[model samples]
Target: MRIVIAGGHGQIALRLERLLAGRGDEVAGIIRKAEQGGDLREVGAEPVVLDLESASVEEVAERLRGADAAVFAAGAGPGSGVTRKDTVDKGAAVLFADAAVRAGVRRFVIVSSMGADPEHRGDEVFDVYLRAKGEADAYVRAQDALDWTILRPGALTDDPGTGLVRLEAHTGRGSVPRDDVAAVLAELVDTPATTGLTLELISGSTPVSVAVRSVAGN
Candidate 1:
């Protein structure tokens, strides 16, 4: 399958690229930095320079041409102000979906935060982040023509992947490694049953690959 990943230089995006490329899938990543292009090429992925904040839907769709699916994995990153959080985290996600619709891309997978649900998220300094994620999640779900899946993960860690993961409709107080999260994203792309579903994930006793397969009763 051909896959397009936004924010391709990120740690999670790199992990996903490696897994998909290893499986012989055609992977293209949109990165902001020119240097990141070399890194993507080293991992067997074609890299395109696309800035989400400034790119138009038509432009993004053009960049995404020939891809079977698009994964929205971009973020504003820590230390970015609240406004940037909304622009990158929420606006960019929405823009990508719009581009997907315009381009007639049927499959989309999004990496979202676990506490995006207002009922589940408590008031805190990160509330802005949560709300932005929540809004983006809802936007994806509202598109009927698009086959979309949102994966909500808890606090992110940078530790080496344990591979094991837990998957459910809702994982309260969950935490997951970034690598594990990438693995799940790869699985979901190929798992038809994962489409149209919103899932929450975290570390578990079973490998992430196994956990992802189990979500669809495989």
Candidate 2:
């Protein structure tokens, strides 16, 4: 399978790239800076640099063409402000989804936060971030051309992955290792049955493959 991931330089995306490439799947990651290319190459993923915040739909679609799947893992870092939350979180997500449609790439996966809600109201940066993610998720869910699966993980931790998780429609709120999250994403990409499902992830007892297969009903 050929997979293209936006926000390719992200911690989770980097982990996912290694997993997919190690499995012999062709992998490409979209990055914002050329310097990040080498990092992607180190993980056996081809890096394509394009700023989602400014790239046009056609430009992005051109990059996505012929890919078996697309993953939206982009985000404005925690240091970013409210405006970027809208632009990167919501706007870029919508653009990427449209590009996937334009390119005829049907399988889409998105990384989202646990408390994300479009109706959420607050003036704080975190609140805005949630709303942005919620709005973007809403857009992806509405697209008919895409077989989209949204993964909303709880608090993300940098600790080592246990390869175990609680994968469900709602897993409440808990922290999961970035490694575990990437493992689940790799599983989700290959599990077509998971299409159209919005799942929650966090550390738990079930093994990664089993957790994913259970949700996918395989």
Candidate 3:
């Protein structure tokens, strides 16, 4: 399989890239800086530098052309304020989906937040971030042309992955290792049966593959 991921330099994305390439899949990562290309290459993923915040739909679509799947893993990152949340989280996500539609990439995945809701009310920066993610998720869910699955993981930790997880529509609040999240994403990208599902992820007793298969079956 050929897979393209936005925010290729992100921690979870890097792990995912390594996993995909190790499995002999052709993987490409979209980054904002040329310097990040070497890191992607180190993990056996081709690097495509394209700023989704400013790139046109046609430009992104061109990059996505012939891709088997696309994953929206981009974000403004820590210390970013409200405006960037909207631009990177909401605007860029919508743009990537549009590009996917134009490129005819049916399978799409988004790394979202647990409480992401367009109706979520608050005033802090985290509040704005959730709203942005929620709005972006709403747009993707509305796209009839795409088979999209949104994975909303709980708090992220750097702990080693146990390869077990609780993936469901409402897994409640918990912490999950980035490794486990990436592992689940790897399975999700391959499970087209998971289409139209917005799943929550956290550490659990069930193995990653089993959890994914169970969700896909549902």
Candidate 4:
């Protein structure tokens, strides 16, 4: 399978790229900086330089051509303000879905946050972030042309992945390793039953493959 990942330089995206490439699948990562290309290449993923915030639908579609699936993993980093949250988190995700439709890619996986809801009441910045994620998820869910799954993981840790997780429509509040999140994403991309599902993930007793299969009814 050929997969395109937005936010190619992100920790989870890089982990997902390595996992897919290690399994002999072709992986391409979309990045904004040319310098990030070498890191992607080192992990066996082709790097395509395109800024999702400024790139047109046609431009993004051209990059997605012939790919089996697309993953929206982009985000405004920790230091970015609320405005960037709207542009990169919300706007970019919508753009990716549009381009996926234009390119005829039916499968899309979104890396969202736990607690992303329009009703979230928090500090100004956090509330804005949640709203952006909520809007992005809503947009993807509304797309009849795409078979999409949104994975919302809790606070991320750098711990090594245990390959175990609790995957459910709503798994409650918890934290999961970034590596484990990536592992779930790798499995989710090929799990058709996960389409239209918005799942929450966290570290748990169930192994990644089994958890995905169980939820997907495979």
Candidate 5:
């Protein structure tokens, strides 16, 4: 598989890259910083430096061309404010979907948050972030040309992955390791039965492959 990951430098994205590259898949990571390219190369992934926030749809399309699938794992960091939340999280996700359609990349996997809802009500920053994620997931689902799966992981921890998770249509409030989240994304890319499904995930007893297969009914 040729996988292109937006926000290639992100924690989960890097983990996913390593997993894919280790298995001999061609991987490309889209990053905004030139220095980040070396890290991707070290993990056996080609690096494409382009700011998704400013890149046009055609520009992104060109990068996505010849790719088997794309993952939208980009996000404005915690330090970023509300405006960036809308632009990076929501806007970039929509742009990537458009580019995927133009590039004829049919499969897309979105890394979203647990509480994301279009009608969510919270404080200033958190609410904006949720709405951004919610809107982005909605946009991806609306793209009839794309086979999309949305994975909404609960509170993330830096703990090492156990490769075990609770995967369901709704897993309620819980926490999961970021490593496990990346593992799930990698598995989902090859699970065609999971297309068009939105699943919630958290730490649990089921192994990664079993969890994914169970939810996908494979």
Candidate 6:
């Protein structure tokens, strides 16, 4: 399979590149900086430097040529303000979906936050971030042209691979290793049943491969 990963330099994105490439798939990573491209190349991914924050939908679609799927894993990261959170997270996500539609790629997997439900709007201190992610999720779900699956993982941690992951709709609050979440994303890419579903995943007692296979129903 040919896959395009946005935010190629991200920890989870790098891990995903390793997993997908190891499976002998054609993988490309879209990054916003040249440094990120070099890092992606080290992990066997063809990197394309394109800033999602300012690129047009057509421009992104042009970069997505020949991709079987695209995964939106981009974020504003630390030191970013509330404005950046909206632009990079929400705006970029919409751009990706639009690009996917134009490129005729039906499969898209987006890494979202656990509490980004549109119905949960409140005056929380992190309201900006929450609303940003929430809007992106709603846009993807409402689009009929794309086969999209939104994976909402909880507070991300840097723990080593635990293999086991819990997958379900609206799974309660919990944190999961970033590695495990990547495992889920990569597996769901190859699992068609995961399409159009919003899954909330966290660590469980099973291995990552096992959990993915269970979700794959094979």
The candidate scoring highest on lDDT is: 2
Q: Model 6 off-target regions past 4 Å?
A: 122-125, 213-218
lDDT of 6 by residue, 4-50 (tens): 99888899999999889989999998988887678888889999989
Model 2: runs farther than 4 Å from truth?
Answer: none
TM-scores of all candidate predictions against the true structure: 0.94, 0.99, 0.99, 0.98, 0.98, 0.94
In angstroms, what RMSD does candidate 3 have relative to the true structure? Answer: 0.7
Give a tens-digit lDDT track for model 1, residues 121-160.
Answer: 6545478888888889999999997899999987899988
Q: Looking at model 5, report the run of 10 residues with the lowest lDDT sum.
A: 117-126
> Per-residue alpha-carbon lDDT of model 2 for 105-164, expressed as tens digits?
999999998989999999999999999999999999999999999999999999999999
**Backbone clashes in model 1, listed as residue pairs:** 163-208
Per-model C-alpha lDDT, please? 0.88, 0.97, 0.96, 0.95, 0.95, 0.86
- Model 1 lDDT-worst window of ten: 117-126
lDDT of 2: 0.97
**Cα RMSD (Å) per model?**
1.7, 0.5, 0.7, 0.8, 0.7, 1.6
Prediction-by-prediction clash tally: 1, 0, 0, 0, 0, 4
C-alpha lDDT (0 to 100) for residue 70 of candidate 2? 98
- Which portions of model 1 miss their true places by more than 4 Å? 118-125
lDDT order of candidates, best first? Answer: 2, 3, 4, 5, 1, 6
**Model 3 agreement with the true structure over 33-93: per-residue lDDT tens digits:** 9999999999999999999989999999999999999999999999999999999999999
Using lDDT as the measure, name the better of candidate 1 and candidate 4: 4
- Candidate 2 is scored at a TM of 0.99
Q: What digit string (tens of lDDT, one per residue) describes model 5 on residues 147-177?
A: 9999999999999999999999999899999
